[model samples]
Every structure is written in structure tokens, then in C-alpha cells.
Target: MSFTVYNFTNNDDVKILHQMGQFQVLQWDRDLSLAPWTAQQAWFASQMDVRRRQLIANLDGRTGVTLQAGAMQWTAGQIQATTGVKGAGDLLGKMVRGAVSQDSMIKPEYTGVGMLVCEPTWQHLLLVDVAQWGGSIVLNDGLFLACDSTLQHALERRSNLSSAVAGNEGLFNLRLNGQGTLVLESPCPQTEVLYIDLQNDEVKIDGNYALAWTAGLQFSVERSGKSLIGSAMGGEGLVNVYRGTGRIMMAPMQAATSYNTLASQPTS
Candidate 1:
């Protein structure tokens, strides 16, 4: 019937970084540590970039939110959960998609007047509006965090066999359709992201840096240049190429390097 989160506000260390409609993204200012690690924590905090854990989808009952299975940290007030599966057919479809995509089979949905908190991590949290993304957004294997109940989820495969084999990404990616706000846990900070909007054009990347792209685009693995010799001379073998008119969000840095930098920026 009532809920009050003490010492969590913009005035405090824990601030509301962003809010879209009913969804609120709360960011902690500093990393918390135990007494034994105080000295180490202080040294690291001062020397390295602080990677704060983010909370997603603080609900207040105007609408409902669906979360990746087991993502919920805590919930308060009048909120209830559902399996988000319509029937036996939907369950079967989810199971099949889960098998290929490696996503949750039965994501839980929560509704009514309450605050839904998600497990915090060092990963960056991005709140995307599906309508602005042309009503469909396909994400790399493991980014889906949470979304409004209005959105729909499906599994989409790469455009060709070469993409599946050479791109070094999974055969099936998670696709979110319909209209609503979707929460994403990006590996890299959004400040470092490069968004490419193509109009009947093409863009290529050497690695799996492209996090999410519009479903309308065609993604395949192709040589860097026209001929085999040219590709070899270019020093780039096969690259993931996205063609057609659509939008893509790419993190320019290599995945492992960026993650290490975020997770543990070593002292210089």
C-alpha cells in the first residue's frame, strides 16, 4: 500500500539518472565495498573509472513491465507477476526460441502499483523507445534486460550462413517488436557509442562491436573489398556488413578491452 526508498534521490549519492514515462533508471554514485577492502576500494575508486550499478524500471502502476527471467532484484507496493505466456502454443514457441537464441524461455511480467528494481551491474543501462526504432530492434545475443508489457519478443536469424559462421556471433539474435520502452544493458558506455543511420547505404565492422540494429537491415559477413586479393591486401579478412536503410548502434572499441576498462581500469 506504501513504499519509501530512503536516501535514494538526485540529492543523495544514488541519483535518478534517467526516466522515460514510468521507467526510472537509478544510478549509484560510488561502488560500495566491505570493511576489509576499504583501502583497496578507495585506491581503485580514485585511480580507475567508477563503474556504478544501475536500477531499471521503477514502476508506479500506469503501465506494466516485463523482465528477463530472474532479473528482478526487489519489488514493493501493489505489484503482481505473470509468466507472460499466453497459452501452450506461446510456451512452445518460447522454448524453441530460447533453445536457439539462449535467452530466457519464460520472461516474467509485473503489473499494478509498485516499484520494480532490477539486479544492478557495472554494465551501462540504455532505455530505448521501440516506436522511435521503427517498432522493431534486434539486439546482439545477451542485451535484453526489461521492457514494457506492450512490446513483443521474437528470435531472428542472421541474413546468411556466412554471417552465422564467420561473424562469430550466435545464429539467432533477440528481436523486440511492438511499441514500448525497452531497457538494455550495454557493454560499453553510451558516450562511446557510434550510431549510424543509413539511407540505402552500407556499413561494415571488423568485430562484433555493433550492439543493436534495426530489423529491416540486412546483416551478413563479407570480404572487406571487392576481390579476394584486395581484401587480403586490406589486412581485413571477413567483416560484418549491414546493408539497406536502417540504424545501428556500434561500440568502436573491442568488446573485451572495453569491458576490462569498465570493469577494472588498472592504475597507471
Candidate 2:
């Protein structure tokens, strides 16, 4: 019930918004604002610095806090908006990609484990800064996590976390390298996340929404080879496979799940 919100004082400084999902009073504005410039009190001012009334203002109103530019919100998997906030510079109608950039200084990139966020639709909030490379989060749904955390050295059970792969699925992984901020969850964010560079060639993915593929591609399971009384006597059968050249981010409606939903997300 809280995707975004930050109201400080009656005005002056803090105020971030985002909740129009199902809509009600509807709120907007994510253009950031600031204070301290000798405190005068101006409320609606976007990227326009003609030195406003210059006492000491530079580009971006000399930087204090002010947001409302454009081009932020992008949908490929799940995005449910319905904006309409008539307040400070209004129109927060889009831009849902918030989670970092209060100035971004995030650090810490090890002690990780297999990742996990396979369901709850994996939600969406990205502000990447993997902190100098070290990869492994392969999940187009089917998350695997084993890294990234801070301040909680408190005691035991810490074998690094994320380890689920015993039967069937095989290599289940989540092995990040350091520096972090990964909140991935895409049943199908408009598909297209490929990486097919093979030497064995043979790809097939009707569902599983691959997040990273290309190890030469070679997985099996294209069943229904005619048996079962000749295709259950006939529904035409013939469909149960995934050959491999290693690259699959399919879901034009693979049907694993998709109707484009929203209820604050997170149900898995």
C-alpha cells in the first residue's frame, strides 16, 4: 500500500509521491526539491534557472530540491499508474523508477548468496550500481539470491544464504559479485532480455522468462513424443520443449501468468 511517499513539513523540503495505482485522491511529483538557499519559500519551480530571483542560484535552481523533468517510467513487465496530483509542480503521472538518486553513494558488494524474488511478481524499483562488477542474478522469475547486505553482523546462520537446487531444475543460482541494488521480478516486462551466443545451438522457451541465458544453450524437455495413446487421442498434443542455443526471454503470453494485474503487487 506504499510504493512511494515522503512528505516533510507543510512544505519547504521533503515531498515524494507515487500511489495512483488503483487511484483515489491521486498524487504526483518526483522532481526532487531542496531547501537552505537562505530559506525564502517558493513551491512550484521546475528546471528553470534564470536565476529565479537570484540571490545565489545556479543551474537546477542552484540545486536544493526540484523534480519534474520527464522520461522515467518504463514498462516491460508490470507498471500500474493512474496519476493526478494537483500540487507542487503537479504531474507525477509517470516516472515510477525510483529507489536511488537522493545522490547515490551506495556501497557494499559481497557476502552475497543466491537471489530470490520469483513471485510477488518480483515488483519493480531499480537504481542500479552493482558496485564495480561481479555478476549473477539470472532470474526472469525463478529468483536466486546470495549476496548484498549491510549492518547485521549480529550472529549466526550466515552461510551466505540463497541455495535451492536439488531436484529437477538443476543449477538454481544467485551469485552476485559485489556492490548492489537488485530488485528484479519480471514475469514478462515486454519480453526481450536475450543473450544467445552459442556453439551448440538449439533454443526454445515458451515460458520461464529467462533473465540471462547463453552458456552455449542446451537444456531438454520438449516432450509429448507421440505416446500417451497418441497425444491423449488428440488435442494435437506436440508441445513441451526447450532445445538450446541459450537465450530465452519469451512471453508474448506464454501463459505462466499474465493478465496485467495490480493490487500493490507481491503475491507471487
The most accurate candidate by lDDT is 1
What's the TM for model 1? 0.87
Candidate lDDT scores, in order, read 0.78, 0.27
lDDT tens per residue, model 2, 1-268: 1132234212443222211111011112222334556234223322221011100001111111111122122222222222223334332211211121111112212111111111112222222223322232232223221122311111111111221121123232222333344332233332333344444555544334444332223333332435757756764333423344444334343332342454233221
| Shift in Å, residue 8, candidate 1 | 2.9
Q: Please give, for residues 225-246, the per-residue lDDT of candidate 1 as tens digits.
A: 8988998999997888899999
In terms of TM-score, which candidate is strongest? 1
